[model samples]
Target: MNKSKSLTIINLAEKAKFYTSLCLGTVAFVSVFAFLFLIPFVVDPAITSLMADYDTVPVTCIATNHIYTEGISNCSWSSCKEGCTKEATRCHQIYVNYSKIPFREFKYQSHVSWDVVETRFLINPEGCGYPPSVNCSHFAKQYGYTTAGTPFPCYYSRVYPEMVVARYSWDDTLRHLVLSLAIPNLLFVASVGVLSYWYCPGCGRTCQKYMHHFPAEEDEYEENTYYNSQSFTKIHG
Candidate 1:
């Protein structure tokens, strides 16, 4: 090829290689990050929500226990005489349960047990007739409750301890697995494959045409022609 044409082809090949390398590198970095970080955060929540919609299994409570906190009072003797008595009490109820269908069975027959607990807090404000001398104001402050005015009667209750299972049908599980794990990897591999096809030396058309011309054969032919020309010049001189 002529010098200018060869130089142009060489520049085009170099630009192609640079862009292909950049594209492959970006794909690799993003794939790694998505697998390690982004995928887990997204897939876990989606899986959990999906399971909640279709895979909740109920089990009976095998054992139960109730723990009560000491009653607290906020009324002084004078206030108590004026029927301004207030008290706060808290109870924690704990339960032990076993899965109905063996939620998770191990080969060794040993597995971790799960427990559930419920907490309830009650506030009672009555006159001096009440027995316990609990300091309701102190209880409210200690338990992070509001005590703006006279502590009115109130109660709070909540249940605890939840379990999530991957209990979808075979088809659903397969679909989620493919979406979460296979798709990203396949996309990355496809991108690398395309880049390799476009920029690989000796194989890709761009690289073969520009970056890897058969210069060794051309050099050998030129050397032979120069030798033949010199011999002719000597003979004529």
Candidate 2:
């Protein structure tokens, strides 16, 4: 009886160790993946904002009324066509006129278009109506067009086009940021789960071995749990 109890305790200890190791391994795996994928979002504002700004098109493209513009941010304009669902409809219509600024390293051309799109969730429709208004007066005094500090200079046109600029709301920016972050995170989690499952086969086998020993030890302790019935039948014969 004492031997059987000792065996059971040893088995339990082994099983516990196996399961603990498995759990620690899984946590470590997930931690590594989280650190790798979550770093960029935390470190760089440009990268974090990159997704949010994805929907914004260049003021130059809007000025010319062109659907697409070279080197402009691309986005689905339809989602905001009616009105933004979240926040205060932080949407606006941008009217950028490039002629007023002085051209130095980069040239500025006055080519513009217009749009009444929701750029963010918090914008009030009262102060900013459905067809948002464009504010072009801010660019008048600047020597050169604001390039958003781009390495390449702003495109200049000799014709002095009255380009209409369209400014995007902050909500669209957030939407893209969230979508971008989600993609890698989901992939990381799936990978960690798969890896955890792959590495845990030994745990199941160990538990099965422990359970199989239970009946044999129990019979020994009870003396006739398994053999008593058969021996009694023989005696009757």
- Please report the candidate that would top lDDT against the real structure: 1
| Local lDDT at 39 for model 2 | 55
lDDT of each: 0.43, 0.40
Q: Estimate each model's TM-score.
A: 0.31, 0.25
At residue 163, what lDDT does model 2 achieve?
Answer: 19
Give per-residue lDDT, candidate 1, residue 85: 25
Backbone clash tally for model 2? 31
lDDT of 1 by residue, 91-186 (tens): 222222333333333223455353332222222111122225444344334333332222121211112124312122434534765676876787
* Cα lDDT tens digits for candidate 2, 62-83: 1211121222134322112222
